[model samples]
Target chain A: MYLRGVKELSLTRSEEDHIKAIHTLTRRDGRAATNAISERLSTKASSVTDMLKKLAEKRLLKHEPYYGAKLTLKGEAVALQLVRRHRLWETFLVDRLGFGWDEVHEVAEQMEHVASEKLVDKLEAYLGHPHFDPHGDPIPDKHGRIRQRKTKSLDSCGPGESVRIVAVSETTDGLLRLLDSKGLRIGTTLVVQEVHAFDGSMDVKPKSGSAFSLSKDVSDHLQVEPS
Target chain B: MYLRGVKELSLTRSEEDHIKAIHTLTRRDGRAATNAISERLSTKASSVTDMLKKLAEKRLLKHEPYYGAKLTLKGEAVALQLVRRHRLWETFLVDRLGFGWDEVHEVAEQMEHVASEKLVDKLEAYLGHPHFDPHGDPIPDKHGRIRQRKTKSLDSCGPGESVRIVAVSETTDGLLRLLDSKGLRIGTTLVVQEVHAFDGSMDVKPKSGSAFSLSKDVSDHLQVEPS
Candidate 1:
């Protein structure tokens, strides 16, 4: 299906939020539950139900009663466009504007809603068309094509396996701060020294820095490719 | 009075639109009338009255029954911030991203509503803290201070006078296009050759180009400084 013009799509901010939330949820869990969407958006589940109904009426998604919501092709396209905008703005904020990678998310959230294709295209050019954002998440191209790399979570790596951080699956401020504190970042090569069976904490040595221990919670969120 | 933090002075998009509209109208007409604001925002006059009342309750502006609205100090501060954001985005679009000056206004309009003080400050730094926008209108500083310039409309210039185009009073797409068609732009130096008193049209010669005639409608909008 062809991507509709932003003007023709004309989704409200709340509708867009729902579309993105559903897209994220479905990608991670195979289906978007009403409760998950509500929790993600900090909105009441009833309000989210109403919004899903409205979006389904617009043919953006199919909301199956028990199975939850699934994005139609059109809905997926809109979500991709939002992701492109969000990641591109994030890149601009951190790369061009000197914003810390940790601080660009909230500002990029607002910038992403500016629905002008020309603006995005111009910005993409100005930024030299970065394939990945500062957080290491792949930025979708204009055609919604994302560059894929085979990787697994840091927690999945066996001891003595060398890996480079490719992406952080969860971008929460707390997690980013933790990564920053440990000098762990995208492209940081490390060898898994040991996995403690006791509590799932892993000791890893960086290519340049000393060894450090990371909890399972943090390792599970760090996507890494074999070095 | 100190400028309020953007979080403390959060305004809805509609409220921000009304404030900018009133700021523009009052600057040109001494007072912002309900009908004028309605026309400017393309909203009903009754709705304008309701919004005016809400803004009055919020201490942003004073709405008189027949006289119109006047901004309080707090309201003026908000308006200046918006102006700062709008102009900075315009400068970025034109100077950095290579958008035509005529095409930047609508996109900048959308961008100006992304209210992050740090984003604005960083953007100002990224754009070299431009003192004037592409249109030659002074960009307000972080403290709501504007760099003032002494200029008069081109229509007010007498024949035999040399001047430089400083700003365009009206920034409508049509006027900008008209100026573009005639190769007229901010900083273009011209000499008034003859003023046709009959139709208020004047013949002007650019510093390095052939002489051309400009209608009073056009000349009146072209602010010029003595060259």
Candidate 2:
């Protein structure tokens, strides 16, 4: 894996972002519609359509009438690089800079497009080869390989089931705050003790902290892997 | 004093850069011409002209015909924020991420425009409130005050005078290689023992290592304050 390997392509901010957004939306559904992407990005449908045409012309995506689009390999490469830079910067900002987990995404988003492979590796080494970013997002390896998760929400686990919380959402700084208030954090072996359907909450006992209840909102934002 | 305070500006990459470049040039020379800026950045003179008009329209720069330009108070504030971000990132990269002194500049140049006041403070805290970056560049205080220098170049000193090498050119990685070969680094003390005239060279003794000869070209690129 060549970390400072030749960049496959240089992309404009808007274009690179559009590709990333499309990849995210298509990850589960296998394709993303113009309308969905437009709504997701808060951009108008017409602008989305225009971008689709431009991206299709650039061979970054496949476009066919009303069928929506998918990322070509070239597009995926750029998207992964963007994701790599973003997560790496996020990890650096939080773990090394003493920034709280919730406050890193906005700045990391802007830093993702920075064109330095060496910076990323040095940062990865500095952070001790962290597999996940501050928010629990998996950082791609030097070759842009992200480990597919064999995990689910921590709150959904059965009582006495051992699991490790792997990630959280950067957008949910408030939710992270809520988790903090409840004494839940990554690597804090979560053992689900109770589930309440009335409010869809869970009582979780961390490795050392006292047992606590997490609202459904908090549960949904956390990712956990069975140990 | 408030490192966690959020910033409110939404300047683009180029615009934020304009504010900072103007701040540096204005502070150094009291005035900066568009063409002069073009040369400093190695961008087209026409591009500088276009950006000058845009920055002026934003009330960031006080531009005059051929008379050179200056930053308004508003512009200075923006520039200080960027400088804070730049030097802080440089320190974070070199001190925390294992990036070498010669490697942080290009990365920091791109990172300086990231719009995050809180991030900078967190970084300063993470780095234990360092007063300087790897290149010996002063890290501005939270209040935008840069520490003044009390050292100068070893080459500028007369025979048998002692001095310390502070910072070097952001553009000279080769000079870094040369300096490293001589066991010289930031904070390393050296005494000018002799001056060579054929190539404007000089001889100096290092703090720990034996004496070595250095070229004038190398000395010119070293940005020392005094010792």
Q: List CA RMSD, all candidates.
A: 1.2, 3.7
Whole-model alpha-carbon lDDT for candidate 2? 0.77
Per-candidate interface DockQ score: 0.92, 0.70
RMSD from true fold, candidate 2: 3.7
Which stretches in model 2 have alpha-carbon errors above 4 Å?
Answer: A1-6, A154-164, A167-178, A187-222, A225-227, B1-7, B27-30, B169-171, B196-200, B207-212, B221-227
Angstrom error at residue A172, model 1: 0.6
Tens-place lDDT per residue, model 2, B1-227, is 33222255578887777677777777667778787687778788788878888888887777786776787766777777788888888887777677877777888998887666677677788778888778787878888777877765555766877777787654467777777767778878777789987788988887676887778877766665445
* Candidate 1 lDDT by residue in tens digits, B1-227: 33665448778999999999999998998889899999999999999999999999999998888789899988988998999999999999999999999999999999999988889998999888899999999999888889999999999999899999999987999999999999999999999999998999999999998999999999999999999
Name model 1 segments beyond 4 Å from true.
A1-7, B5-7
Residues A1-227, model 2: lDDT tens digits: 33233375667888977988897788746789998889777899899999999999988888887989888777777777778888888888777667777677778888887778788777778778877877778888888888676778765677788788887753555787777777677777877888898998988888786887888877877788887
Docking class of 2: medium
For the candidates in turn, chain A alone yields TM-scores of: 0.96, 0.87
Could you tell me the lDDT of residue A166 within candidate 2?
Answer: 80
